[model samples]
Target: MRRLGLLRLALGLAFVAGVSAARADGLIVSLSSREVVIASNYQGGSITVFGAALDKDGEVRPPGPYDLVVTVRGPLETIDVREKTRVLGMWINRRGRDFVRAPTFLAVLTNRPVAEIADPATLKREDLGLEAAAERRIAGAGERPTPEDAAFVAALRRLQEGRRLWREDARGVDFIGASLFQGEIALPPNVPFGTFDVEVRLMQQGETLARQTTSFQVVKSNFEARVAGLAEDRRLAYGLVAVGLALLLGWLASVIFRRD
Candidate 1:
């Protein structure tokens, strides 16, 4: 009888440990830089995002066949998409839809094909892929989108891709060993200035084991900052300054090309 009681207690303790291990399987993510400066002559740059897996005891574990996904999203903005119609043999904008709080920039990096990592429903629920991201509609869309609305969304995605503001790289993340992984995200020259969120997800067997998020700032340099502040805080003064500069440039041009 005592032996039976001891066995039951041992089984219960083991079960509790197993549950704790499952709960502790998590990811730790970090970025090389927390802030990025966009100077007047800034073109573009890249940031390194890296992370490791943590065991139940909160210790780094040997690297496994874990999948990693890194997503960088910029500040949201209201986007207006206009559809054109041919009128009198000329194309003219006739209808438009406004997408409020749409991400101005989005870049994704994955160790493997996203389809192989998660199902369509899971991907859509987590916004894990480009199609999922594009399908995300904010509030005030008035009604559920129709086929035409989908077409407009596709057009907008194409435009973003052309500008290099949105991208997806299949081989972007690389695993260094059993426990560590890293990825790179390219910041285009035209990346908007604002706070950007970076998300790292670790998945196994089509299940998200852990996820973490970090943030960084894209800020203008001193000169650009001053100009932006003036434009926002003192619009009249900014306009006057712009006009003064234009006049000065015109006068200089006239002198340089004076007929003699």
Candidate 2:
């Protein structure tokens, strides 16, 4: 049994070594901050989210709430991110600046706030998830929404249902926190040593306005052996059985001694 176990471990190591040469991509997006606080009164105006720009060695902070600042470098419409609670939309209390502030207006600009974009790219209407007219107005709002804009309005309503999508405006900014957004993706033990794709997106209303796609790779530089082998052989299988027996024996011994 021990020989079989050793053989299985060796084979597992060999397979891993072969895959070690395989490479993967690590896509790191450095946002303004991983955490942020949207005061109650951030009403629907140009909103400003802050954080560092993207870099090779991205910034890291202890896990907590943060607002990821949006930074794009191209002719593409840039979208920002903010938090919104149930009561206070994204508006800041203009008066106190400490509490959340809800604007009197029923509807304000649902999209586009304080903006710094590289250049405008062809707005993918599909990404906007707006009807032809609403997408047109938002992409190039000449005036009030056209009949086509109804679709756009509906899209926003749908987005508000659960509030999973993140936005830049103050509309729902007050209730948000870093916990709402995604953090790092963890690679599994036998994650076929290679690059994996990580997708990041910006949604307004219910549509995707912009997207930043990147990848992350796992290297064989640091590997632990035990995790690599439990999958393949009966030898390791027997080891598990041995562990179970040992645990049971210990429990039984403890019970007998306690009774005495």
Which candidate wins on lDDT? Answer: 1
TM per candidate: 0.82, 0.21
* Total backbone collisions, model 2: 52
Q: Give me the candidate number with maximum TM-score.
A: 1
Query: For candidate 2, lDDT tens digit of each residue in 1-260?
Result: 64653444344334423533221221123222222222233222221221111223433323332222222111122221133334465654231111111110111112233222111232333222122212342444344555544444445434422242222332322212221222222222223333333334444334333345433333333222243444345577868877998999999999989865
lDDT of 2 at 206: 40
Tens digit of lDDT per residue, candidate 1, span 1-260?
54643344344335434433223347766666778998988989987776667777877777777788888889988878788999999999997767677778888899888888889778868888676677665334433567777787787778888999988888988776467666777999999989999988888877888888878899998999988999999999999999999999999999999998
- Give the least accurate 10-residue stretch of model 1, judged by summed lDDT: 15-24
Alpha-carbon runs more than 4 Å astray in model 1: 1-25, 138-145, 249-260
Output the lDDT of residue 142, model 1.
Answer: 34
The deviation in Å at residue 199 for candidate 2 is: 1.7
The alpha-carbon deviation from the true structure for residue 247 of candidate 2, after best TM-score superposition, in angstroms, is 7.2
